[model samples]
Target: MALKELEVRYATKRSRDYKLADGEGLHLLVRPNGSKLWRMKYRFEGREKLLSFGAYPQLGLAEARLKRAAARLELAAGRDPGARPDRKPAMTFEKAARAWHEHRAASLDPGHAARTLARLERDAFPALGKTDIRAVTSADVLAMVRSVEARGALDVSRRLKQHVSQIYRFAIPHGWADTDPAAYLSDLLKPKPRVRHMARVGMEELPKLVQAIDAYDGEETPRRRAVTRAALLFTLFSWARTNETRLATWDEFEGLETAEPLWRVPAARMKMEREHLVPLSTQAAALLVSLREISKTGFVFPGDKPNQPISQNTMIYGCYRMGYRGRQTVHGFRGLASTWANEAESYRPDWIEMALAHAERDEVRGAYNSALYLTPRRRMLQDWGNLVEHMVTSDAGVRRDDVEEVGPPLTAVA
Candidate 1:
């Protein structure tokens, strides 16, 4: 007779061992040591196999029955119960993300790579870190994206989608899973809000900004003041990105072998991934020479911590201190330079873009190009700087036309 619950309980009390038969090849074994185990006997691939259903009592009879039902359903669908690849051990999403990051670490910028990894560790890992990769569905990914979006980290959510997509691609080639759940993430992501800081500073505001930056006194900390001052000036003259300038290392700058004792930025620090030549004007080169004495150890703008560059926030705080807070942004320096060149009419747009290390986005045009617009860009930067310098030092030379004629020049008076 098939074992009943009461008979099994009696057997356990008398002989300290009991066996209960669950219909359709399932059985429960309860031992004297109070251990219960679920086992399924089945045929697959022309062989008989016993599959363990995990610990009993801990999993409970109901849970064990549910697992048995799932296995039976698989068999009914003509799937092999023993040869099931889906049941094989799989990695958690967090583990997959790490594995993917490791493969591409060398190709990414250090700052960006670190931040990406840290974000995943903080946001995505705790909830889904332990789940098997193959078992994770599109719904799971959508849920994670929504969580990030709800927290007002929409940009992060977008980037996380890209990161997860890369992970899925990595998983596909490895035979881990057949589908990329992250593929649909683009449609699921919330649209990014328009940021108002995209505006470029007008020519009229350029001089006042320069003058404010120049005359502004920083904190009592001499190192802080000097570094902040240097960063502002470098932004004006170099037209480099905020991070590129702030993170400058002493090693990236090499004294030129030519006339004005210029300092060159290396390929790695530059956005174009190519070495940049900065023909330092007298004032610019002097600033570099002065900085070399104080910043001789490591970074040109070393933080309070040894060997690290000043935080990006330092330059931002300096902007606030100089009274250019909401009127402009740290990234506006690029716009100011680009706008000034456009208004000058003598400078080439491509030359300005090259100076800022922006490669032409037009793929066909970019593929055939290899020049770095050194001379024209240098002249444009100098001309722009001269205009700012002139306005800051004296008010008499300030031209009202510089501001009025900027975007679309009103038809020049006949």
Candidate 2:
């Protein structure tokens, strides 16, 4: 008999089992102990599956019907809820973001990834992260971005948009959300203004700057003195990105090769996403070898913790100690190299691009090849390093009278 609510309610607690069918594969089972339970019978992969809703009147008739309808829709979409024999409960954005962080944290320099996630949690998660992934919309994301923009942190707001887009993309592949709202809001959000690269110090100013750094005498703070000297020489010889070479570790380096020892930075740490072999001239190698003796613990330039590389702010403090306030920065070293390297025709345009880790200008070649030009790059770096060493010691023979030419390509065996 088709069971009604009143009939089932009026039934006294008898020592018998009763079966009640609600059609469309849903059934309610009333036990002898007066407990009512809901269950659904379905088939998938040629095997029968049973899904339980909950006990009534806890779940109630109306709620159970709604759940059954949703389950039927999932079945129609070819997803079997009963497929996973050991399914865990859903994870929240905070949990997912932490998991993403753990995997990506060590790839970059210290604390960058962690700081990014902390910002996301503090500014982003509070608004929409707690809500179920599927429930978030474009409006929700737009509002969060607008809030950041209102704070006058335009750069941060722009970055937040990218981070949120990454999170959304992360969520979509993991079945958390359907679309990335931030991806659609690019035109809607304010565009960040272009920032000019720091100007390279001119030849006339270079001598004065070098003289100032050389003549400066400060208290014997081992870490401060060593790191500052290292930064100055590193800027000259390496001619690589200040941030890239700043996070150097003992494990990453290989000893001097032939005339000048070349330090090969692993592809993982490089901005180019390819292995970079840097030519360490006599001056650069001497600086590194000396630094190794003092900072033998872990990093080449150890920080206050004595286990990590020197802090990013150390260069600023070093500049202050050197009696150069509002002069040039540690990063200004790259500008010096860039301007000089570009002026020299001996350096191939491609070699300069590779050294800078810039992508290939040729669309056809860039599409097929992503790795940086390593072979000619090694020679170019060596030439650049040698030039810097020559200039430092006031060697007139080291004049830029000749072009910077790359000798041959270096094949990395390992």
Candidate 3:
């Protein structure tokens, strides 16, 4: 008789092992220890064989019957249902992709590598992960791309296709795949949107913005407020990206007490994947000293989470708190610094570019100019620091004219 689900559920263990047959070679093997295992008894080539279809509850009755039906089909085709295939198992798409990611991650930043793996797991894995690398058709890849695009994530969709193509490229060289299925998928995606620059205050308004940042006390604890304030000031004074500043650690700094304090940003953390040197001015170094007294984690601006730096939005929200939302961004400080320094005749354009860490276009020039202008860049930053300090100490509603009258001249560095 075919066993009812209730009977399977209520079946109790006896003092020994026993079998409850559901007919057609499908049965439940109930043991004395209250374990229910699914097994199939069949004959192939005049020889009797046994196949295990996992355990009960996990395998369930209907799924086990499905497995039995499939096994019967295999038997009809003259293939052994329990025997292993002669050839090796094919490499799965997930396996090939993970191998590629591991190889690719060595040259990538740790955070970037983690985000890439996360995108794969979230989007690609569910659709094509278990399929054989060679068996993944272009249509299958397109389906995954369209699924992401349907949700208004055109950028993610485009990047997903790129990553898929890269995976195939990695696979083909390893003999895991014969062709790149994702190679021609670029045209199928939507067009990329235009770039919009971040908002920032003009040179004339910088002093007022500086004053606002000084007075910002956005409903947080005194310690949290101080950390956010210091993060913003450091980013402004050094003109480093908020991402670089937020992720900074104590060991990245050197010679803080000396005349030549430096922040050595590791190659992995930088946008161009090259080591960058930020010459810290006295104001920037002083902020670090104050941060060291209250900082509880390894990060210079530690967040609420354990051992993690503050979020990239910490400084952005600080700007918002000072009523500058949509008028300024944390990254705008770089533009402001560039404009101020470039307008001044004393500061060299290359020195300003190096201070901003903009990648030099020519490779040979980039390599040759890597350490060429540290001294001049340091002098420029010190002048910038002095200007910022002067603004903070001056009147609350200070203007460009007032700053020009009382502060160090913009061209005073040279």
Candidate 4:
């Protein structure tokens, strides 16, 4: 017979342990010490097993019955209720974080994913790893963030908080956590330091820089010098980042001998993770033609090691050799290009931004604008290339007429 609630409450403890049977393998085990525990007896594969549902009154009669019903459901599904309960293992902060990282890593670049994991391991794991993710309070998160901030890594602290918040955000949907402890941490962190822009030369000084690059002879071999000059010039003319140009392969270039010469940068190498189209001008095409004749490796600018691209410091060292140390950077060429184009009345700002491969701020607009301004951007870059060529070939520097000429019309080239 099933035990009644009043009987369960009024049941007396005996000298030895005793049980009041509830129906269907569920019973209340009342001990001599005045402790009552809910237990269940079930058969799985001809073997009897016992499952505890906690102390009586705490689990209550109705809840214990529900547990029995759930256990029977588990048995009906061919699973052992005693061995494998419906509840999963407690989710710790580190475990949740790692799970989140694994889920996030699928869409991220390998290097970026590695760095994110490294940051979590370095800043978050030591303090919060073993703590239950649901139990982690805002104060607990703040303490960990403060520890990082104490070491003067304000930026790291900020990123750590963001990572923690993201972990919680990832956990909540899966029922691992109920609250995000790191959500309010952004306001608590120290203000970031002032922004420092990369060093770059002014437009007025561009002619002298171009002249210096043309006459550059710092490399031991003439062939090495040619490689350096071509690499730098290509970066400048294409308005591409130094790393993009450094990692360029011959296969990325197309239609070199034709009118519509192009450099198709793959999305993997790009900073924004989007493929960029660079319409190679007449001068830029000529540089690639020269590079092809002296190509040593797959990389357009082969580094010291075989099958490797040029080092990050290679172009920086080239700028240093040109006596522009601390005055200009290889990356600064894009800034100069942006400044020149924005100041020019002929070029559209959107076309100039597209040429620079800057990400559009609006997601919907960015999706719609992908490679949409190609024709106008091509003309803008071609005009910029003409101005660069004029500066390089002329001793008198860039004149108004030269900037206005931009060689022949788009029809003549295309």
In model 1, the worst 10-residue window by lDDT is 405-414
Residue 347 displacement (Å), model 4: 5.5
Q: Pick the candidate with the highest lDDT.
A: 3
Give TM per candidate. 0.54, 0.52, 0.55, 0.61
Off by over 4 Å in 3: 1-91, 105-114, 152-155, 191-196, 211-228, 240-252, 258-279, 294-326, 338-414
Q: What is the C-alpha lDDT of each candidate?
A: 0.67, 0.63, 0.81, 0.78
Which ranking of candidates, highest lDDT first?
3, 4, 1, 2
lDDT of 1 by residue, 1-414 (tens): 443555433435224545578777778766555656677777766645566676555666667778888998988898866554656356667778789899988877666677778878877776556666765666677888899999999878877777777788898678654446677567767998885664445777776777666554665665566667667776776777787787776656555333444456666666555566665544455556556656746777767777788887887788888776776777888888787788779977778777767768785698688777767766776676566556556433323333221211111110
State each model's C-alpha RMSD to the native: 16.2, 16.0, 18.0, 14.3
In TM-score terms, candidate 2 sits at 0.52
lDDT of 2 by residue, 293-347 (tens): 5675767766667577767776656666766566666677767766777887777
346-383: candidate 4 lDDT, tens digit per residue: 88877887888887867568757646476777788888
lDDT by residue for model 3 over 350-394, one digit each (tens)?
898888888786756875774648899899999999898777744
What stretches of model 1 exceed 4 Å from their correct place? 1-87, 90-99, 109-115, 124-132, 198-201, 208-230, 240-249, 256-283, 291-331, 342-414
Best by TM-score: 4
